[model samples]
Target: MCYLYNVESQNTKGPGHSRSLEVPPVRVLLFILATFLGFVLLELWLYWQSKDKPLQLGLWDLIFWGLLIFWSVRVEVRLPLNAGMSQLFLFALALVVLTPPWVAPLAAFLAQWGGSAWYKEFFNRSQDGLATAIAALVWILAQENPLYLGRWDLSDGVGIAAAAFSFFAVNSSLVAFVIHLDSQTPLREIWRRNMGWVALSYILLSPLALLLARAYETPLLGGWGGWTVLFFLIPLYYSRFYWDEKVRLEEAFDTTLELLMNALEAKDPMTRLHSERVADIARDLARKVKDGDEAYAQAIYRAARLHDIGKIAIPEAVLLKPGTLTPEEFALIQSHTTKGAELLSPARKVAFDQLVYNVILHHHERWDGRGYPKRLAGHEIPEEARIVGLADAYEAMTAGRPYRKAKTPEEALREVQELSGHQFDPRLVEAFTELWEQNPIWRDRHAYLAAKEGSVSRSTSPQRSSASASPSPSEPGPRTSEE
Candidate 1:
């Protein structure tokens, strides 16, 4: 296979023009033939590995291959065959000449469709494309340099440049074709996101090609390097894209939920900050009770935030009532829970939607089964709903409404504790009491203010002393019996 001995030595002195020895046409043909056979074998091995599941060749596949062949043919026809062209030209020409017309189309189709599908499932197309392009370029460059090619002959670098350029050009072009066939996502965006993987492909594969060229004492064609690069880079690119898309999707969902929350708050001004405050408190308590399970705590928080989402269906007049509600008005207010469940049920994709829906629908449920909508008792109520219930009561007591003064944090805690096992879960109440004890002074001040407003007077003693141990000025001097 060594043709170097037959070629005239450049150092030899000759009177006439030196004639270069040429390999027999048959030898060159055989070398070309063997390279393709090698490629076929490698492809067969790959096919076998993935053979259990047959690859689906669909309409998109046809389009992808068709575009690839068209471009590859165009590039082949356009290649300048001047002396400056590297040996890569000969190699590429031989391969193209040897390949059946149908092969290029098939390869093109597979590259395009397979690449696109892979990107959609697991990779960033642009990144993968970039890496592949870079790898192809480097491979082309290595092939053109006689020193690098191990042929001990100087050849122009044009072949390497052309090979690199054409390979990446074809790959990226195929990618674009696949993008067009896939979805409405802008091709440019897909390209941008996957470009890194493309660059990485080149970075990883070029060295392998160089090593193969050295080992075989021939150009690196029909080797495992290309397929290996694809196997590794494709999945890597896919994973990056998958993760990025997942995060973006999550953010979008979160933004939508926030918008919904805002709309709900807008509909009932009295509950403007109520849900948010309750969510914060519930999340805090859930963290304690759930043993630092952040996910569970988050679920509780979201449930609390959306606990009154059903109240959007309630009339504004009833929700913002400044005076005592009639029995009929109270009954109307009770309908918000079921309405909230109904509203959230349609938004099933929302994170923790079920938990939020349950909290919204059952936050009013008493531990004794006296709660509205569904009179679910004790453990029958979801834990998230239970947490939201405590948060709701705490926020209601500590925040002033039109008909009531804000209860002190301490008074709120006391009321919740009193209602444990009757209105609130006993375990939740214990957690609330622990939280309140951490800030006694703030709690007492709010309790005094709540008592002064006469909002909680029906529940708490009107003559109770202030935290200062002094009788409240607002206390009536004495109760007057009929004189």
Candidate 2:
């Protein structure tokens, strides 16, 4: 289940595919209920803070709120951020600066209504108003009379930045959490993938939002005089367009890669979805090994997936062969590592990473120096390749192959343990061994369910060493897992 930018929708319960994925009913209700409670609490706090002043709505305020509702609904982008992007923050900042504390949440609700209708999603509205209200409350609490925001002084930079930071930080965290709940993906991965890159975007845009708010009040350039603010605003829209295009291009790339995976599977049924499973497993292994380097973990996942993509160039006869291959045939098959590296070299134009290439070329190399075109050993092999190397082997062992029956998870784990420090990096083996204990059936369960209860039972079996290499397309190297 490889996820695209939209994240994987394994159990899509939306009315139709036209709508983006939604939070489950239970979570949505919980989130909405929490928002309502928070809204009530903030209102009470603002009332006390404002010396018991009643929240009043005047016609002029209504006019401004209407403009906010309009822009927030119409202007939006899908940046690297998981949440849908909206310049609504611009007007929310304005409301906080120009109006009293209680008005911000009221305006947020009205503004979110417009966006809800535009997106036609109830869950979207939940997060939309929820974040703005929180941001408004933060601004109110910060300045008591954040009315100073009307001044837009560089002297108050610390306070202004604090409110602005709270707004985005709370909003991004809330949205990322919802995404994690909906997707059942790890929360850390979700944050790194969706929220990490958006931080700079938010930083660059926050001051502009405040600037626009301040400019709107100046008699010389405000709307009351003329549309002078448009001069500063048109560029932000352009930037939004640029970011939107970037997201679209990324989607296109993911779709293209998915299509390639489909083609690879079609060419050889033995490999059908094998890479995806390996990718999932490899990612988990990478997390255990590195703990926090998400980008590197993703690279390892992609590398594991494409480790055998070079097989695309090998003759189908050799790929699908059901018996032991001759020496020449084995050698031809082994060339896939180099061939894959060559095939992917052009991706540099698209900013494809060097680690992907390294993993593809070196995944077959053993830790003990007995493997591959380079015969690289131990620390000489890239750690990324080592991670995928163990993952690839695990997948091959647990899965049934054309040449031999699948080993149970226990058997596979035992074999991997035996190969530690020889076929696999000792450190990675320790990491994977932990995962094997935590969840031997992490990928799929059929094998583990039927596997012998203990590794000791499988110790006497004949191991697939050099002579058994290249038994079939399924088992194609001295190390079947790397193959």
Candidate 3:
């Protein structure tokens, strides 16, 4: 799908292009300013057109519906990365269907009266007003006077669906576009993680807006249409609670994984940021291998972060030893793969998918069946496991321990290339070689750390050296290159 952002590629040859999607702070601010001005112009034009036309809704009618929509916005549920969702769209769509074409944008603009940042509040107003205005136009083309309809037919249902899709398309694209510009995240990934699940609520819930409008147009139980709108709140409030529960569950799972990662970090100080680096590389590689499957790439990233979680159960003596391990000590190190899997088995039923268990258990397995607990060879090993294994090996080599000095990025890349088809998947090895040539921030440990800590200078060239080094025969660690 096409995204609403700019992507510039580096003038270099590689398996993937180096995309520069990051926008400057000043540019983002200017974009927000432009959006606000555009909204003002559109609202003014819409008002001017409607000034001479007779309006159907009275002042009290607009006030009543606007108040309901404002209250809906007040209870918006907060999401990650300073985003939020609410059922305000339900009332907004209903307003579009029930009122004149010009009324929807005005109600939407006035609903953004209170928020944290003045600029952000105004931007939200602009985007919402624009989306509603577009939806109102769609409704006008389909049904000239929806307020006067007696009974609905299939064509009327189609009209409502089309209008709902138009609103969501414009609204979601604008919000996702700003986030894409600011954070350099892929638009597909952002939508998958944040907006994909809520899409059904936006589209499938369109019919409810029709019900809301009908209830308002034809009062029941001898009550006013305003009273019927108030009663419609019961089901909408429950639906809002369902969304809240989903977000809460996701947050709880994230917190649990973080706690486990912290415990593992405490036991092995050498692996302080090792998992994070591996995860970053693994995610990029997975995206390339899977042909830009954002959801699968995200799963690979999460599983990579916890691939070595089993090491936490190992004794500190074995974990922190600075010398070569004895035969028995090495056996204990090998057991960490199974130990990690068993430790997280309970979570498998909760939030952990089968992919996570596979990574924890089989990342140590080799393509030639020469490594690890199961000795699974070739395609027998899960693809996720192979991807994480290669990433783990690369990170372990580059990140030095107390006994072994760290390999330079050039040395590590050479070693990885040399081991292809033996300890690593040859296909993945080629992918990684191409990725390294692109000079991503995660190519160097220091670069990755600098980027993580918010430093802008992260340029590094791939060092081309003829020196070839073999993988260490007995580096002896829980998650070393040799394994």
- Using all chains and alpha carbons, the TM-scores for the candidates as numbered come to 0.47, 0.82, 0.86
Which residue pairs in candidate 3 have backbone atoms (N, alpha carbon, C) closer than 3 angstroms, thus clashing?
Answer: 310-340
The number of the candidate with the highest TM-score is 3
Model 1 misplaced regions, further than 4 Å: 1-227, 349-352, 439-483
Please report the TM-score between candidate 2 and the true structure.
0.82
Model 1 gets an lDDT of: 0.49
Residue pairs clashing in model 2 are 393-481
Ten residues in sequence with the least summed lDDT for candidate 1? 77-86
- Model 2 spans with C-alpha error above 4 angstroms: 1-24, 51-65, 78-83, 114-130, 141-155, 181-183, 222-226, 349-351, 440-479
Model 2: how far residue 148 lies from native, Å: 15
- How many steric overlaps does candidate 1 have? 35
